[model samples]
Structures are given as structure tokens and as C-alpha cells.
Target: MPYFRPIALALCAFALAVPVAAQEVNVYSYREPALIQPLMDGFTEQTGIAVNVAFLNKGMIERLRAEGRRSPADLVFTTDISRLHSVVSAGLTQPVTEAKLTDNIPAAYRDPGNHWFGLTVRARVIYASKARVKKGGVTSYEDLADPKWQGRICTRSGTHSYMLALTAAYLHHHGEANTLNWLKAVKANLARKPQGNDRAQVKAIWAGECDISLGNTYYMGQMLADPEQQDWASSVSIEFPVFEGAGTHVNVSGMAMTKFAPNRAEALALMAYLAAPAAQEVYASDNYEYPIAPGTQADPLVQSWGSFEADPVNLSTIAELRSEALLLTELADFDG
Candidate 1:
């Protein structure tokens, strides 16, 4: 992950010159433009308010923190619970006042101060080599730690935010010692040095470089849907493991309002709109994430993975445990 910088910028000349009350929203997002543009269009179409966006590759919380109150961003639409946690910890973001967000999003997936709210969920799932692993052989997150699976794993570095969120979840349920040991066991089983994103893991399995790897539910969706990745998708099988006594490891793409938002009401409206059923569904269908709002259902591709019990642990707890998770990751000794 890298930090984004503030390159002193002025708003549109007309926007800056216009009197207040024109109703506009400016969002800085890590989510891909194609995935969110439709929703932005919908918001503009329905509200008749213009929306400005800036697309980023994966990391901006740290950058926003550096920008401080000078940041022009009204809202930060991001993925990764750990990243959202970082933003809240820095006090660069604030809570939304809209009751709709509170009513629509669950407490577990949001911040206590309402500083951030999850828009969608992506499960940390297993993608097994269909030729090597049987359909019913693996069905839980705990299975990855078993001795029998030694030397069969392929994954990204544990230091990556993706795995840290999972490590945080394990710590939440099994405690540090047990989760630490499990991570060590998993480290010992690696077929190669950890490297690449979730999609690369699936590709590794396809190449017979490894039999299984950790994957995000959405990557599986794009792999299956994209003509270029269809071959990779075909070589693997998707699994949702409930982790023995704990819930499945899951993460999210979330939103938070900037502390110094120039348009506070517009920011709150954008956050509330994202939590609404229509926007939630758009996130689900477009990003293949499980909608954070209760009545919002997942996309068809996500539904095919089969349901499992999700870790009931509140994400704030995971945020609180980030340091511990980082330490455990270092202890695991991953580099790839």
C-alpha cells in the first residue's frame, strides 16, 4: 500500500464561485470507477446534485491523515476494514447524522461513534484446486491450519491488510496464542513464498504451483465473469468455511465522512445514500460484496459460494487489535 498526496487543487471555478446551497457531493474513493460510477450517476439523476470523484488504487487513509483538515475530500469511500479503522483512529473522519445509515447498517460492521459504515462485505474464502481437493473435503477456515494440509498453501503476505483483518478476526475468537499458532502452522504449509493479490492465488492453483489459496469473494466473481480470467476461475473451486466454532472471516468496503468536509450535509447525504437499499444493492451487484444493510442481498455470484456463519465480532474490535495483528504477522515471517 502507498500514500496519496495533496497536490494543492482548487475546486471547479464555477463550484467555488457559486453561493452555498447548490447541493453538491465530492467523493474520494478507492473503489474502481466503473463499479461506482453508476451509483454516482443515479445519485445525480435523482437528487439533481453534481458529484465529483477521484479514483485511487487501494490506499489513501494515510494520505488523508497527512492532508489533515486541508483535505478537500468530503467523503472517503473505501474498502478494507483495517484501513477504515486507521482513518477513525487518526480522527480525520467523523460520524454521519442520518438515521437511515444507522438503521440500515449493523453495529458489527460500523464504527461506534458512527465515524465509518460498511457498504459491502467480502468473505476471506478458500479457492481449492478442483483436481486435487474434493468438494466436501474442506469446509471450514480451521481446516487450513491442520497438519495434513502442510506444504499445500499459497497466499499473499500475512502483512497485507487483507490477511491482517482475518488475523484480527481469529484473535477475536480464539485469542492471540491459538491464532498465532494457527498462523504459524499456515506459514509452514506454504508451497512458495507468499506473493500476489487474491486473483494471483487462484492463478497459482491453476498452474499447479499450489493447491489452495486465500481469496476474496469479489475476485472470484470477476475471474468467473471476465473472459480473460475465466480459465483461472474454472481451475479452482470456491469454499466458504465457517471456522469450526467461529464465524467466517469477512471484510468490507466502507465509507467515512471527513472531519473538515466543506459540505457536511452533502457528505452525510452521500453516506446515507450509500447505506440505502438501492446503493447497497448496486455495490453488491457491481462489486460482488455482501451488502452491509440488513434487507440488502448479495449478488448472484456471491450467493453461489454457499452461506456460512460470519464472525459476529464487531469490526471495531478488529480495528482495535491491528497492532497485535501486525505483530503476529511479523512473527509468521512472510515475504513474497
Candidate 2:
């Protein structure tokens, strides 16, 4: 069994001493508590419903399954469409048709079945060397495979969720054959064998080992905030590359209600609160992710990066294609 480090919100501690049933909601989150502490704190402050979180580094689904109806979790928070979809597909989540959720999150960012709702969005963008690459040099996703970029690209493993999501989107747009060819071409263009996290690729760019890398947009904000990595971040510029006819590829950090939520009403309230404008603002300003709620703007720093239309394909569709994307990545020996 995987162990989860429990995190009790400071404001909720008073509930522990109360004799009567406590007004609280339990969360099983793959996301670090610090990243979401502000939103959770706000929810508790507004509703007086205590928030208790179990931070799980891995095995969220397995833990839920093992606990079954006895699971103390009311909600599950995670990033990536694949993970959110996996929970719903595993029968661990229930449909949430709250108008507050449906109205705030764009349809493309939510589950068609109402099983999950995205709180924030981040693009899979190109991090290009400011000195080495010309503006407008990298125009689209297809451009990455051009012979001109051979030995000039750096990226994490193709099997990583972020990469797979992009590949799955490619599959949606161009079908398997073209996606496989693109994968092979991009692999052939690697400066080194696929390695490291998205930020590591940026560090490689700063080292002059590569000219550009594929990475999520939030990583730029994360890098800039770190004193040591600021130089790596400064060496690169974020570019929103589009698909041939559509828009830039994106993924999300989202939430879902557990099937057997003990505090169903409170959980629903938290879910609605998370989707509302106030919580959306916290996601944007604090975590550096783009808020999903309509009319919410990203942090000023995030806004300075410029914007592009997010790919219109429903994220659930991309999630459904993740297996094929992974298979294609393996067949192409993308990490080799």
C-alpha cells in the first residue's frame, strides 16, 4: 500500500477538538498542498468547512480502490486529462452537473460526462533560445520535425504525460501514420536521447546543448521564480506553436468528486467554489496556471508571454487516445 502524507489546513485544526460531526471535506491530491493551499484556505474561510488533504506522490487510484466505500476522500485533485479521465474510467468518480462548474469551465476543458472539471489550463509550448532562434522561426508543431531543426531540439521522454497528450492531439489532427512519422522525425532531431523534466530541457538550452525544447507554459513562471534557474529561463522565449489548422495544444489541472463522498454536500460546495472566479484567480496568480473560469485573466507575468487560441478538441478525446499515443511512442523508440 502506498502511504499518503496527510496535510491538515491550519484554519481547519479547530474542527479536530469539536465533539459533534465536523464540517469538513477530505481530499486525495496528486498536486502538492502548497500549490493549492490558498484556494483550500479560502474555501474553508468562506464556508467554515475544514479541508484535510492527503498528498499522494503516486498510487492515488490504487489507494482509493483499496479504501473503497470506506475511503475518507471527498475529492481528488490532479493535473493532466489522462489522470482525471483515468479516475472517472475506473469508476471512482461521480457525475457533477453543478451549473457553477459547467458555466465556469469551458466545454473543451471538461469531461463530456461531467465527471471532472478543469480549474486551470497550461499550454504545451516551445521554449526557444532567444539568441539562437529567430522570431517566427518555429511556426507550428509540424515545423519541429523539419530537417532544419535536426540536432537542435531537446525534450523530455515522449512517454511522459505532457508529451503523450501532445502526441494524442497530433493523432486527433493527423491520424496515426502521420503522428508516428512526426514522432520519429522529432526523435531523430533530438540533441541527446530524451531525458529529464521540462525544466531540464530549458537548462540544456541555456548550456547551448540545444536551441529549443517542448515544455509547459507554467514551467516558465516556475523557473523565473527560482533564483538559480532565472538565467535558464531568461535564455529562452516562450512560443505558442499551433497545429496545422487548429490552435496551441494544452493540458489542465482539475478536480473531481469521489464516488462515495462522505461529505457530499460540502464536497459539492468546494467544487463549486473552486470553479468560481475567486478561486480561479488564486490558481492564476499563485500557481502560474491560466484560469479556466470565463472572464478570469492569467497573472500579469503569464500575460506578458502573449496568448494563442487553445486547441478546440475536447480534452476527454485526447485522454482517450493516450494509450495509442504511448504505444506509438514506444514503437518509435522515442526515448532511445
Highest TM-score among the candidates is held by which one? 2
Put down candidate 1 lDDT per residue, 168-199, tens digits, no spaces: 78787788898888888888788988888999
lDDT of 2 by residue, 33-152 (tens): 898888889889988999999999899999999999999999999978899999999999999888999999999989999999999999999999999998777879999999999999
Candidate with maximal lDDT: 2
C-alpha TM-score for every candidate: 0.90, 0.94
Q: Which stretches of candidate 1 lie over 4 Å from their true place?
A: 1-21, 62-66
Note the residue pairs that clash in candidate 2: none
Displacement of residue 69 (Cα, Å) in model 2 is 0.4
TM-score computed on alpha carbons, candidate 2: 0.94
Could you tell me how far off, in angstroms, the CA of residue 274 lies in candidate 2 after the best superposition? 0.6
lDDT, residue 114, candidate 2: 95
